[model samples]
Target: MQCDICQRSPSSRLPFNCTLCARNTLYQPRIQLAQSLLQKEALEKEVDQNVAGTPKPTRIIPAPGGKPSEPNPSWIVQRAAAEQIVSEEKTQGIHDHVKTLREEIQNTKAEIAARKARLQKRRSEFASAKQELSKSQTGAVENMDKSMRRTEHRWDILHNKTAESRLFLCREAALLYGLHQRKRKKGGLGRDVYFVGGVPIADLRDLNSMDSFDYGLRQADSSIDASPAHVTTSNTNLAHLVHLVSHYLSLRLPAEITLPHRDYPLPTILSPGSSYTGREVPFPGSTPSHSSNNSPSASRHADQRSLPRPRPLHLDKKLSALAKDDQVAYASFVEGIAFLAWDIAWLCKTQGLNVGGNSWEDVCAMGKNLWQLLLAPPPRPSVSREPSSKTPPQKPSLSRPSTAAARTLQPENPKDVPPLGHFSHGTAYGYLATASGTEYMRDWGLQHPLRVIEKVKAMLLAERTGAEWEILEGNEWEEEEAGSEAKKETKKDVVRPGIEETVILVRPGGVESGINEGSGGTEREESDGKGRGASGWMKLKSR
Candidate 1:
């Protein structure tokens, strides 16, 4: 047989046997070894046949004819030798398999990390949503309390018994600041102000370099002794600004003053209103009184039933945001606030409140600063306007976006429509330009600017045309519920409208001239012949 261990050699025990196979192959590890021994024995028999000690004859073994042996122990040894030759190849293959698996594991880990980031972002969004919900609830409760207080208070009784009156900024900025007040028996304005409280305009820097990051709200002491304090006439037209200031001053006032009657505007020779209450009657006193008949006692029962929430700071309240002064950044903001103030004053037809001295550009910058101050929502109190109702739920005028220019002046509402942020005086001027080129006013060849202003004012203030609300309620989903409330609550105004003075001048009827070319020296002025700019309106002198 062929030996698997020594590939080229033949086994000694094969077919029958050979003499050489008998001597040397017997030590092998298979049946062949035993067979070789038996063959050697047969040679001994041959020797016996040979008489005496004659030489033995050679024996030959031949190959078997075709069939191969079955797998036995001898075959097993052959297989083991074949397996050993292939062992290194098999080992290398196993190493490659392990390497492939490690790469796969790394890829899986990377995928898991990406998914984890997505989960974290989703969690943050959910948290913010929850916070907004809590705020809305608290706001609702506070509004309800304020509504109760205003509704139950017997305002008329307080009006008959008492009278009242109320600035920005850092004390040093008073010259550039405005003054606001609320007064009694004023038929015209609810809010009005002189210059916002400030120091000399020159002393104030154009840019607010000192960081307001460290500023904080300190609660005014709620408990104080009743005593005489500084009191002034207040106007309803400017009441919002006044309310904000009065409340702010309440925190630091050296003397406690009594509130007065309905807030009246600072007086003017010609107060523009249905009936004129001209100029404020300054109360001569070393100290102003703190007692304005409190919201009448009759009204207290209903008002006392609930915990009153604090009132929100109004337009005049000092809001400070620190941003760049350029028009692209913060100028628009200042303009919006100024516009709100000026518009309100005009609507009430109050006098002496026009924005002057400082350019509209500067006012817009101020507004931008205020936006930062509004980071957290200011407190808002709901005042009821229902006709003497003693009830569970009373309706109140929504203060947000109440004035015509309010929406125009405010920064964007998080949930409101885009492009609805505040506007500056310059923006207003652009909006009103060239509305009607053909219409002109003439009085027997003599035209007056007063007549022209009235015409333009009426046109600009006229209700919006062709705008309508659309409702989309279908299967499509959105981030928030589509709201009609936004449309209904929208208010339009410029700055604190009533506190700042405003004017509109149109040359007769449709014939109009702009403030830019009002000077007679201009060639265009001679051609238009629309007469001089606002000659005798209440705001004319202020301008």
Candidate 2:
């Protein structure tokens, strides 16, 4: 038969007790005790009957059966012995059960204690892990905060530099326009002069209306006062700056016809040597590239005569793509070009030169030639070649344009310059509207770094401040002339401001660098303790 509790087949060799039947066996102790009491009662009754009321007259019929062994005294003695043995056996069984129960109790207590100790150990481990996790999270947060701070610092530096550039360009354009206006008044050119687009010069919008520099300056100063350490611009501020510059340039150069100077400032910062150097060298394969036999004087003379070549003014396709992707940057680049053109025009007008013309080719040619003179190299013997079977040896000419030579040449009249064609608005603005053309122009604009704006501003600031003076005395004329020629040579070259000339650090007072703006200091002291003296340009602060 199957057991009821465990549902297993019962074993035949042992008792067929189920799990429930075994649990019910705990009542066996009471049953055993009852049975022992009953046996004792029965034995006592028999003994009483035999001892007190034994009326079973074993008459004299068995008188001969020995004296009946004294009615079996042996029976009473045996009964007493049996009773004692049963009592002792029952007591031993109870004692053994109690001992087994005590051992079980001890084993259970030990198990419970071990379980509690294990639980406490686990709890401590959990607590330590939790604490470590919290520490790690705190450290991660701190590291993130530090990273953000560094990124913010870098952004501030870039933003401030950009702001300064924008301000300098605006101020320069304004000053230059003012100068042009004054000269125009003096010459009777009339503000009503009609441009190729039929728009009167006077009709152009004034730059003063788009003065983001002043607004930004105020905000920057306020920010500096509020924090005195870190200052940043909102997107709104940056967009406003871009719009202001773009609008100003639009008004200044409304159309290509309204271009301040005929391709003035050209697309390149430097003019090419072969085209503008005014001298020619024999074909490359005809002669060796260098001659070791030339003396130091000859080499020096050659160096003085040779001007640095102009960088090609072509647009880089890759850079153009990058610029096109950034509309604001592209706009900034165009505006920068417009500012440079305006400045050049003003410079030419002040020198009593005509910059306006109708012929595109002529304008480009004139601008290039002008650049050659403005950035003339040190006086060198002009190279002239004589006819010979072999490549003619070149001879250097001594004649070079100087103040003396400049005084002799007459500037052309604008009226005499031929017009190429009627101005077309579509052609002028069309290129800018397209991606490819815009990118191309952007590439050209980037040829000149933004630092040029700083240089120009520094130059203008020095002139305005007037705290510095240049002395032309004694033999200083000859020396000055030579220096002036050298200066012109590097003008069109890719010249950049020295470290002393740039705003290296922003300070609470304003801006700080090694540049000294004061005029009274010794030459060495002015050049940051170097003997070179301060450069012609001085450093400027944003304010």
Candidate 3:
């Protein structure tokens, strides 16, 4: 048999169990029970001994009417001790709560003090910043005032300089061109007036104004053939003046100039060396001695209406950009000026005048600034008339005449005469010296001359198109097309030969009207001459 606890064969007579292990297990519970019983009895004996050693409390009775007897001393002492213990516990809790509240109050005061310090620092910073802002604002205002004052002073100086320069140029130009100054009374006021060959050209105060000069030129051109004896000499002088101005300024003119004449095939242009003698053309019905006033108004109107508009001399980029009507107006204005210049040059040769002096270089040098103000800028390299070559063009040698007689004598050779562009070289130097001058010259040329050209252009355009001229930004002029249509209608009614001929058709019903109607009629008639009825065509002669 095997023992379960020891895993050994049992030597006892029990079934499948060791006799020594069984005896130990059975006696272990009994030994533990006996030790517990002994411990419980010992505890009980100690409690009984404690009870026996303690004295019992005695009870007392009081008489009915007697006061309550005093309490037992031991009971009083125990109750007093319990009350003292509770009082100590309450005092400790109160002290703890008071300490905690005091700590919280101290922490709150610290936080408030820190916040106040931060606020004070922010206030001081704000005040300093405000003072700095005030100082900076005052300084900026003072600077602005100083700059404005400086600008005003500069503007005043520039205005004075411009006025002085204009006066000098006008005086020099008048002296050189033989303009005489006179005091004229008008409207109960006396003013200095400049006269070119007895014709009032401009007032002294308006010498700087280009419009004044252009208006004067137009008046002089209209009065060219007014009289014969007195006006001839005056016109000769005027022509000399116009020639000098045009030559020195290098003003561009049309290729031909049409002068008002009685000749049938009128003198289209006056050649450089040719002399012009006024001649009368004998028509089929008119005699050579018949004056224009003796002719019928209908014949005069027909003659005037038949004349064609002159073509432009050259179509540069600027002229090419303009409308057809504008180009005609421009050509007419330039050609009129060219005629005055060309006529004088022709007359100078016929009269045997020694006016072609070789003192052009001296004159240019003496009035350098004046020439710069009057002469137009040189043409661009692309448009320059100079021949293309690697070598530069040589400057003409100026002849210094020794005696007064020699100075009065004309040059023997034509090559000795200075070229027209040489007179403008001094003006060109002024422009070519600086970038700003180059740009200004390229765009507008000299200021006064440009203004004169613009004024003449506007006047010619107004005369031709009946458009009101209006000044725009940058001193540019624009023509208003408000009354242009009416003017164009009037122009269409008057047919010019070899330019535009309006055809009128007479139907069987006696109705006569133009071949086409409206503005597009001219274009249609010129393009294909289509859509015309088979009626008889009648040309409307100007009355």
Candidate 4:
């Protein structure tokens, strides 16, 4: 029998078992090989069955009534399902994106509308504010214009009248000075004295300096030979020069006096609306009655309440910043002018004579000096107003013989014309040139300088008396309450008239005659009492 354990015949008989030695190696090899071959054959048979079975044609299922249909593969069904799921997800995502976009668009529209509303509101508010500002500015401009016109009118009246009277006073002073100088000199010069304008145009240096004494003497001597044209030309030139000086003086003098310092404000003349009454110049021998209830400072404040606030020229600020030397020079120059004006004013009241047409500048230029104008004899009677050659008339000349040429040069009937002392016109109007300078003087009523001075004096006196309420009405404090009873009580408070009763009267024309009357009385009393009295007017002149 063929052995199963070994492929070859068993070398050792063991009844289908290999020999013990060959059992492991040979027998085991044979058995494994046979089993492997059998398993390979079986696998091939199974594979063949599966391949051959799939060859079974795809089944065509008949539809209920018509055409046959092919069954779909499972994978294709799954793929379709997956594709559907993906498409659904994509659609959902697209929808969500579109919704978010719509929401963003709606939010943008709402934001745009809100911004536009805010911008419109702001623009309207700006326009309203701008309109209000324009209205306010226009109103302010109108008010300022009205105030300026009123102030200017007041200034014109006050300044022009004051200047006119003051000029007259100054002329009077020059005459006085001239008389005094003449008194000092024992005898009058050989030349006859005559007056032209306010100047004593004599050959003496004491009376005039512009022309040398020799030249003036020669001219007076040659009056007998001089032509009318020469005399007229000379007088015209003199008048013109005097006019120029006065014009410049008016502008400069006030500026110096009215400019504010760090410590002091402008005076009332320059600042009409200002309520600042300057340092109260007390009346002579008039001590302010001090009370236990009121201190000096308190009284001053009370007095200040009646006055306007002082306005100063802003130009002083520049001076304050200047060097010390410059400041001192400026101050001295201003003081010099003020002092000169004061001196000239003083001479007028003391002299008792008024020199018409003569101004401060005229006195300075035409006169030798203040002493000379006061002391020297009157100017030689000459051609003050020369006549034309056709109708020349003769006037006697002290210096030379009467000739036809001299007669023509001399004024016709010198005594027939009013004397300088007789003419009392204010300097501003006394000369044609000075009158030109005061174009602003039109419509201004005449006022006495002394009257204005007296008013200032009374105001000061009132202040010193601690009666501020008396000087300017409506300046005093009253206890006002809200109730009707308080009003009745306030009404019961009567105004007591005192020294200041006439103070207000002094400013207006109503009391001008009265002021003159009072002043005349005061002057007579002063003149009779102490030989030289320092009345309020005199005191102001002294200042």
Candidate 5:
């Protein structure tokens, strides 16, 4: 059964609390992490010890001062000092007899020197002739050229290794993402949906829109969803955001926003890969393989002798999926990507979380950022509301557009509002239309560790103020305390026929029925302050 607060299946085994509840209730996840880290460290050590030809140090004994001396001296020391001295004196007499032999050798050496001087004169002439024959240019320049080539070769090898390792990491991250996607379809470990500030959101929706988000739901072809799913269009939701943040702040998406460079920047478009280096040895029986086959595809690319050749720009394999977009979109994607990377860096260092490999770190980290993105408030509305924007609030109850300042949450003129306001008409009710279409928020189970619904709900419900108190309640009976609660139940009937009925996943504080049942709309058209009695959007004070 789902926990009332987090609405997740808690782990029931002895000594094991529910992982969902554990996350909500506990501040640290140390024990499980410590065990995993210890295991990895052991594996690394085992690998290190198995490598071949590692050297071992030598052992030695010490001497008093001089190093080890002659073995005969050691024996002599063992004998009595007088006996050793007498033996040495007898040897000296033999040495005097050898002195006569030395004199005779000196006389022979003098004769030999005279003959050698004549031989040396002949050798000198031949040596000079040989030097003339081999007058090669063996100068400092040649030595410098050789050293430089070696350095360049080493640089190339290092570069290729670094690039390949990075590519492997990116590929791994993509694979991990794919696994999470499949698990979500099978409903294995449900980390897809999570709540933040009490609002439920799906990570897949952030990555992909709603129509494409549903998977495990009933389908006609398979068992997922027997009938075609009815989904609200994304435009209306965009309208609701305009009502909530932009309309108030009057901000809009800027003409442009400055973006930072990539998490790992690529090289110049014109330059070839770093200078080539060390060759790869052939595998086992392939000893005949080329000596320099080690470099990656990018560096090994040949036939580019022409000037300013175009280079193939490949991203790290893990990051390659992101490399497909056009410049502007690529730039936009990176902003979110960089933010995710920063978050991972923080978690790995501060939380002591075991991130495992580069791929795991990248995907999970991206999921983390995607999870928080829901809390990122919309930009204020534009200087002038776009034609597509909610019609100037007048006649708002109907679908008709008006040129006047439509009655909205603000102090709208009677002229601003039509006699028949768009209570459920126009795009004004888009948020309600949106809330009804929460399937878009379900994809989080596939991409994150926390189920999407729980995370979003927490963000929306955790610190409910007087305004949000009713929406966060666990049951329908208790939700009536909110002033707007009455209208919420009434509004459930307002949904167009064939759309799914109200089903809110209460979290953090408790389970909730329909959000509308307890949390009624502000009477936006008539509201004086930020509160619009029936139409204004609710906002997080915590943000």
Candidate 6:
């Protein structure tokens, strides 16, 4: 059998189980009650201890025999209230924290937007700047290329012009001096030589080759070994030939050549003797001879005096030496060659020689012709019969207008009339006769080198200052003619004095007075005060 409290434990229990069960059953309820009472007391004590120092107006102590104390409604309500307050405070603090977080997020978003806008603006500005920089770089490159091309073009043009000028100079020199190339007998190589009337003056090697001359010129600035021996020889020969030709032309030409270095003296090809034999003299500073009879000072003075005067168209030193020593002197020497050529052509033209066209070839041909004529041998004089006994009949002189009448009747075209101081027919014919080899030996002898030099020097001082005198004088004559023509035109427009007309004035008292006035009637009216009298009426009639 099962016990009431344990259920089915008595059969398997020990011998004293029943008595112990009865005892446990009786005191179990009391023990349980006592435990419950003790727990209540402990809880009360704990509660009292918790409120020991505080005065509690809402608390009530229960009687010992009263029903077990119920939970205090006030205390429960207080606890709930405290919990609600804590929850509400936490919710409010959370709301405030959420609001602060929201504000911070909005500020961050605005700052990000502003930064994006600034970045976009910067990107656009950078793109525009890059485009501008690219365009500027392209433009600068194109401009630099254009400048280089322009500079090259200009340099080419300048180089071409310089080459043409040099070629023209060489052509003119060849023409003036009658330079020609002749084949040598042994080597078959051509040698350049210049002649005056077929008489050879100087032998030049390879002068016709401008390249060789330029090479020599270039080499002259450097060492002597830089140039070939033939080129140097050619240059030396050309310089000597130029000296001879210049001296010969200077002696014949009326005006001086006006070369460079008139103040500073140099060496010359002219000798100190009476005749110019084309001997090379020492430098102008050196003394060639000493005289025992004279004192040192007097001898020095005599030697200085005896030194030949510097030639106008000539160089003081050789061209190669000039090139090495002074560039200006070298350039002047080249210019002097051109001047000498021009002088020769001008002389031929002045003497009525036929100078052809402006081309260098034509000028060369003309120069050659003129040189032949000038250097030709005199024609032998032929025997003539005695003078005729009968006198030649005089021709009737034609009546001509006076100088003033001729000037008044000058032609409208000024070219039809000769300028003042123009060469006369007789002088032109005399030059023609001399050039045609018809002049007497004695007359031709007057044109000898020595005599011509003296005569030309005197005539140059008196008449000519430069080679362009004739050209300047012609231009001046043209200007004067133009002025004279203008004066003639103005004179035609002028009114001349004519027959006088007599005016008779009648006064108010019937007295009559006569006045003689020419074409200046307006002047008489302005001069006389009574001419405009209001009381008198005047009548005018033409006669």
Backbone clashes in each candidate structure, one number apiece? 109, 5, 0, 20, 79, 1
Instruction: Write one digit per residue (lDDT tens) for candidate 4, span 91-140.
Output: 99999999999999999999999999988998899999889989998999
> Each candidate: RMSD to true structure?
31.1, 31.6, 26.6, 30.5, 47.9, 37.0
Q: Is candidate 5 or candidate 6 better by TM-score?
A: 6
TM-score of each candidate structure, all chains considered together: 0.16, 0.21, 0.27, 0.27, 0.19, 0.25
Q: Write the per-residue lDDT of candidate 3 for residues 70-119, one digit (tens) a residue.
A: 43466555656766787899999999999999999999999999999999
Score residue 88 of candidate 3 by CA lDDT: 96
Select the stronger candidate by TM-score from 2 and 3.
3
Question: For candidate 1, what is the total of clashing residue pairs?
Answer: 109
Candidate models: Cα lDDT each: 0.28, 0.34, 0.37, 0.34, 0.30, 0.38
Q: Model 3: which ten-residue window has the lowest total lDDT?
A: 360-369
CA shift at 343, candidate 1, in angstroms? 16
Model 6: residues >4 Å from true position, as ranges?
1-95, 136-140, 147-151, 177-179, 185-237, 240-543
By TM-score, rank the candidates, best first.
3, 4, 6, 2, 5, 1
The C-alpha local distance difference test score for the whole of candidate 1 amounts to 0.28
| 491 Cα displacement, candidate 1 (Å) | 46
What digit string (tens of lDDT, one per residue) describes model 2 on residues 313-432? 122222223243754433333333333343333223222233322211112222222332222222222213321222211211112335432333224443432111111112343223
lDDT of 1 at 116: 84
Q: How high a TM-score does candidate 6 get?
A: 0.25
Which candidate leads in TM-score?
3
C-alpha lDDT of candidate 2 relative to the true structure: 0.34
lDDT of 5 by residue, 242-348 (tens): 12322222222111111113421222121112112122212112222333465677446733342222121222221212333343333333333232233322222
TM-score of 1: 0.16
